[model samples]
Target: MEKAGLAEFNVKIVESCLVPPCLPSPRATLYLSNLDNQPLVRTDSNVLLVYEVCENVLPDPAKTIREALSKVLVYYYPVAGRLRKKEDGKLQVECTGEGVLFVEAMVDKSLSVLGDLDQLKPSFKQLLFRFPSNTAIEDVHPMVIQVNHFACGGFVVAVSFQHMVCDGRGVGQFLKGLGEMARGHVKPSIEPVWYRELLKPKNIPVHDLELTKEKIESTSDSWIPLIYKESTQMSLTLDFETVKYVKDGIMLECLDNCTTFEIVAALVWQARTRVLEIPHTQNVSIFFAVDVRRSFNPPLPNGYYGNGVVAIGAQAIAHDVINQPLSYLVNMIKKTKMSLTNEYLISIIDTDQFLLDIYSNQANIILSDWRWLGFNEVDFGSGSPVNICPIYWNENGPNISNGFVFVHSPKRKCDAFKVIVWMPPQEFNLLEIEIEAITNKYVVNGSNY
Candidate 1:
């Protein structure tokens, strides 16, 4: 008989490896997209997926997983290469197959000692994962994985990737392949596809849009996310009922319109604006990464394995955003999504400098939804992960970018959403109050309980 999960947090290293791709991939340079080269997006993407394996049920799980990774890399070979700048000053992966980093550690603790999974913080990451010394693309390994074994028989698997390589959905595909191989599947359910040529900028790049230029020029030094006056992070939990209430409330105002993302994002955008108390005349914007894989004229391959997303900007005056009703904000968000046409994507790709300008100077809120990434499917034989913590769990960690992430909460009794928000402490408190108040406003179906 054996206990499951973790028992405590005391940890120590046991094994490690520099696991390279099993087969040498062709030496080539994989290009980066305009969205990829943004100063804001140039951070190492790190994540922790925790699972509870029965005690001694599997021997040398680390080595076994490493072997699976090697095979997986043979197909997803670019991950094993290094990110370098070419003579043209563009970023690309030099497919030298230098190998990725994998580490195995043993912890004197168990999941029980770690306390609630939903309350995961930076300490949990520092203990269970192998964090890169820095977030620099050249400094940190583009890819790394850490396997930790707890005394109570549970283990945690963490993976860090260079953001320049792929987006979240792309990474999920790779992880799924790794899991399938670990489970004895020779090939992945969806074979790897790298169509980098599909997103190449058009000849004589077009920068004709006035809106793009206006939005790009809106950002001033006043709102630089880098300048902080006691910034903080808040990990919030929202149940399905509360979310429904929000949706319903917005529907009333918009005549059966608005999405959960729209409502929630509108609230967050407005709340942050309110908290910041910026001048009414000043301009503000919200940024979202639109998945253009399907929006392209000739859609990308089903399993296209590159950064196939474009950054969309939603802008308005501070006064308008703050004074306008939530529906107004929601409508703006909806419009932004509706505007990501094939042509718009190419326009951004061609003269992405304008978009890049906005991204570099604006201190706007960047929200990326991770609920649909299917992280639970990253099973490596023992069992599906009990919890999956997204990039930068807390404020003190590396690359605390001025962005927020939405993830599925591990709420036992019901479905819920967890929004990881990075903002000033005062704003977070205010946003918390606003969030509760907003949910309570239209709780027609027992949402307040």
Candidate 2:
């Protein structure tokens, strides 16, 4: 037995054990050095993190799966902590703690279709929806990877984590390291880096960025769990060329340069707004996650493990959003993108001091774009998922309307992208005609269109 790998693993375990217990809450205390200058703040509120694991070895699957997860947890321990506020005005954790506090593992009975990536993707999503919130952070143990062997002897591994500790990109890097370890490739080239000093708030005069105080206070209303009615899966293939055509039409009409995500998102936003028929004076917001890896000074290491993204939103009145041409919508989206600069992100974080105040009067109508965010790379050993959908975990019922759109690689043609949207049934119906029109236009225009 090559003790070398074990020795290296032990080193990580010891380092995690030595992390100081200092924080207002476990969530806010742990900070990344690389994201020091940037606003990578964690909220006391919990977030769900999910991943799909593919494996080739299948004998005695349950035990094998558990063993793998156990080893992975040893590396992820320090990053697992709960967010808490102290009685005094200070923010820090009591320095007397050890072992895992906010990680768990459980079997999802629905993941039996491990061999079929298409079916497995959707099933995995539903699994995230059923995750319990009452589990003790101290007892929550990671490596809850589940093994569901398919009829063909292949198996899928689903690992869920709390987003309060790490961001998606951070988890992705961790999984890549774990995969290498499982494949007998230890001593990863990329070492994990922990830098909390950089994240400390600046003492100099902070700029006052202009944002709707009312909108900032209303995020709580937007946090409600989405309501779903008659959800079904559909598959369609639109290659990059077709995607480009649709994007071009939206840009030409909107009088602005819009990314593929912006165009598709504008379409969905318009469609949903139409169905909801919200009051003209009422505003709707489109929320999207922005990756801030490169936004930091010195930049995060390729192997950093933690949350490193921020949520940015664009708002418009219901009538303005619904009745606008695709081009105008695209322009609106473009402006929203430009507004998410470093100063804007910092201003948003500053508003966190009043989260409860803002969330109390939040309005309805929010959209999340998961298409261009690299969520489809969930490959266990079989292959990448044909479709990956997001599950809403908020406790409150839909606050009017909410939706998530994911772009997946087409099963028939890998080069093409397939867009699958999840939303309230009525909204889906309203957008059906416009969606078809866009698709039909793409077909008629062919590659050139």
Candidate 2 C-alpha lDDT tens digits along 1-449: 42221111100011112222222223334533323212223322111222333454435443433343344444554543333334532333222234232222344222333222222133333232233556543344322333333333433344454454555555555555545444444433356655545445453334655564664554544333333533433323446765777776655665666677776677667766666556676767766666665665556566555556655566777678867666777777677667656655545444432122222222343344445444455433334444443333334422123434445553445676655444444455656766767556745765553
RMSD each, Å: 4.0, 9.5
| Number of backbone clashes in candidate 1 | 6
Tens digits of per-residue lDDT for model 1, 366-408: 8788877767678788766776766454335533435778777
- Model 1 score (lDDT): 0.72
Give the CA lDDT, 0 to 100, for residue 166 in model 2: 56
Relative to the true structure, how large is the alpha-carbon lDDT of every model?
0.72, 0.46
lDDT of 2 at 128: 29
